[model samples]
Target: MSSQPYRLYYDRMTSAFVPHVMLEEMGVDYELVHIDTGVDAHETEEFRAINPNMLIPTLGLPDGRTFGENGAQLVMLGDLHPESGMVPRIGDEDRPAFLQWLFAIATTGHTTIRRYSYPEEYSTRYDAQDSVSEAAYRQLTRFYSVLDGVISGEPWFLPRGFGPLDIYTILILIPFEGDALADILDTRPSLARLHAATHARPTVERLWNFYFGADA
Candidate 1:
């Protein structure tokens, strides 16, 4: 960890979840700037000034630089702590696969989730919103299935054991709460097992309790 404190603009269960968990796992001291997107906090000029794109999960590093985009953050963190296992060492055989999966989640899975959660962003037609959401759901299901098949017999996303990519992937499933989430997990046995295992970790469980209560 650097002498200066790293700052993160975050909201519970949002894309911020990944870096939040990763920071804890890395045992680094950081500050959380909780953004209440529910009240359009992210749209305010203050927030927009920090992140021109007005996205949550924006990060300000100790070096006095800030960045948006989850995939970029992951790579930046991994580069900072190469020995931390957040990513494969550069030029390693697993490096390509790790980058591939990371980008896939960021591009395909993350976008579909955004569409599913906020269909109005995709279209102004009130009646067509349901169709947009439904299409997003279908795409999300396929993404989950692809991940399930890849991690069929493994305990982690990569053969090298748990890393930042696992944290990112697990956070991808956090929004699918309640029975809808359960039903989807049931169909993907391997993913269900992974979710359960990750959920049991101390840091993850602690965050769950803090954000969603003990029962959650």
Candidate 2:
């Protein structure tokens, strides 16, 4: 057993759900430190100790090293425990494709969701004469269409089989689901298939129910 028992500092519910599900899937003994994110508890000193950027999902290892950011953390977990089989390390051949879609989801997909979901931030930006909500919807729809065209019934983001990429992609959508999710999925059947597969998995369902039963 590894001495690096994982510790998660995250919101009660958020994209942290992704790695939370991944750890459960890995069946690793871990500890969680719930900070009730967005209450600005995440902005405090104690929380900042783990992640200077004040990000959630920071994992502290037994070696005294800590990590933050969902993408980097999952990739590191995959590296530390090969049995987890979630991602490639510095030298692994799977790195390229895994990293590619990782960036795609985080940047092209996740950011757009957040940008639109919070119209207050973009409402005054000069980028649009249209309503901030409309621009956000348009950006989200474009990405959803792209996702629909790409993913198939395959379990993974790439053809490499289910791993961190798929986990993160599905988890990124947690903040923006419900009727909007259905609408987005309607535009892209592929994403709906991918979402269904991820949510249907027993491990994912367990975490989803626990994290998002009422909130999501």
Clashes of 2: 0
Question: Candidate 1, residues 19-131: lDDT per residue as tens digits?
Answer: 77777887777899999888999999998889999998999998878889998888888788786876788898888888888999999988888899899999989999999
lDDT of 2 by residue, 1-216 (tens): 457677877676667887787788888878888877667888889877878988777887757677787777777777777877667666777677677777788877777767766766666766563577677677767776776676643644666567776777676566566896787777776677778887789988887777778754
The lDDT, on a scale of 0 to 1, for candidate 1 is 0.82
Score each candidate by Cα lDDT. Answer: 0.82, 0.73
Write down the RMSD of candidate 1 (Cα, Å). Answer: 2.3
Query: TM-score of each candidate?
Result: 0.90, 0.84
Candidate 1 deviant stretches above 4 angstroms: 212-216
RMSD in order of candidates: 2.3, 2.9
State the weakest 10-residue window (summed lDDT) of model 1: 207-216
lDDT of 1 at 168: 70
- Candidate 2 has which clashing residue pairs, if any? none
Candidate 1 colliding pairs:
none
**Once superposed on the true structure, which residue ranges of model 2 sit more than 4 Å away at CA?**
89-93, 123-130, 152-155, 175-179
